[model samples]
Target: MSNLFVKDIVVSYSGLPIIDRLNISIPDHKITTIIGPNGCGKSTLLKTIARILKTDRGAVFLDGKAIQQLSTKKVAKRMAILPQSSEVPPGLTIFELVSYGRFPHQRGLGTLKLEDLKQIDWAIQVTGLSELKDRPVVALSGGQRQRVWIAMALAQDTDILILDEPTTYLDLAHQLDILLLLEKLNKEEERTIIMVLHDLNLASRFSHNMIAMKEGSIVAEGPPSKVMTSSTIQKVFDIDANLTICPFSTNPILHSYQLSGCTQDLLENANEG
Candidate 1:
């Protein structure tokens, strides 16, 4: 089990800060979700943790060791990240795409090892893509293509998995399927899963811990019950909404109101009256 800690980190682009002195800790072998409005630096934070984006200030520590000090190959062996979008080769087969995940583990000029084969098989099985293993990546549906990308990440066999908007284009069923797969990986395989999610309800249901950000800073973080409050949502999103507890789970459910013409006029009249 390895813990990821971000200490007072700040990320900037073109001399403008996007992540401002943020501190966060992701527990080992748990599923953590980051939620916020667009451009709130959720993806930026995840990228920094994965070492894709270099931090201008502070440090990211994995298992108490500074991540910057580690070599790229070493970091790749310990952590795998699936960015929001991936570049697909025009004629690459699923197996070829998934095999790229083994690059970090392989030695120079060595053949594919048994462990690699096993890992690739496991990734394919877990992502439910065994049937499409030989198919061309360009031929798969959007959901299937997403699953293939996930399979590639899984084939990396790293302890920490960072995903940015893994369910972006998927429909409801596929989104749930991916969430359940990540949950299983965390619980059964003892892997740490960190992801960025826009859907508040899905984040509350799937994540063991949640971090909510606003305007390049962390606003609230903890279990869904503690962080997903009406006040927090309103403050972060600038929207009036009702919060209720789900019947089965104690997570807060946000019901947003879309003010109509009549309702807006009535509210104004009430204030004037």
Candidate 2:
């Protein structure tokens, strides 16, 4: 399978390393989720690979070509990225926002052509935003706004989609809504997806591959069955967890979890002191 390869990448902020010599191969046409605790460089790695952030060393390779060497428009034609927090303009309508995705293909003044309109409409329909095409993005609910951003990405018509914490700031139902939409896109359009996810259970359920990281280093990467073990979770997250296999789906499920030591024991020790 084709892969997006990161070779010896190093990223630093203020002379302190965030990601050090990180090497990973993200398989094409599959949903790959990166899971880790906060400040673990998951978002930084995604940004570097998407060329939104400059790498201090090494490079990201897309299909054997260095991503940095490619023109911005060239890269945009092949991949689209939706970052964690995107600031929208004051009053851009959903249709207008989605239409902006066609900029890379436009020759003059960034005006939408006939094909652009078709693509924007398709993106809106697929994301269930057809009725709200004229709605101001700032006025929409969180989930609706998220879908609008996703529709904009879809309108880019790229084979690879990279999202940083796509489900952030949403209720459980809305989170599932976005994830299910991504699964459908992957299955039907064969879009290769890479994302940073905070929820382990949801990541395991939807990801074809999972990369677990800690302290800017990858601890484990493989199918969820191989990487989502009790030991691996403890090692990567430093949290005690029970890993159970679901009888029906056979997927690894995180049972009950807590701090490694008992609360009662801590209280007893405190009283003794």
- Per-model tally of clashing residue pairs: 0, 0
Give one digit per residue, the lDDT tens place, for model 2 in 91-169: 9999999998887888868878899999999999999999999989999999999999999999999999999999999
After superposition, the stretches of candidate 1 with alpha carbons farther than 4 Å from their true spots are 247-249, 258-273
* lDDT of candidate 2 at residue 255, scale 0 to 100: 78
**Model 1 RMSD to the real structure?**
3.1
Q: What is the C-alpha RMSD of each candidate to the true structure, in Å?
A: 3.1, 3.0
Question: What stretches of model 2 exceed 4 Å from their correct place?
Answer: 246-249, 263-273
Q: What is the lDDT of candidate 2?
A: 0.91
Worst 10 residues of 1 by lDDT: 254-263
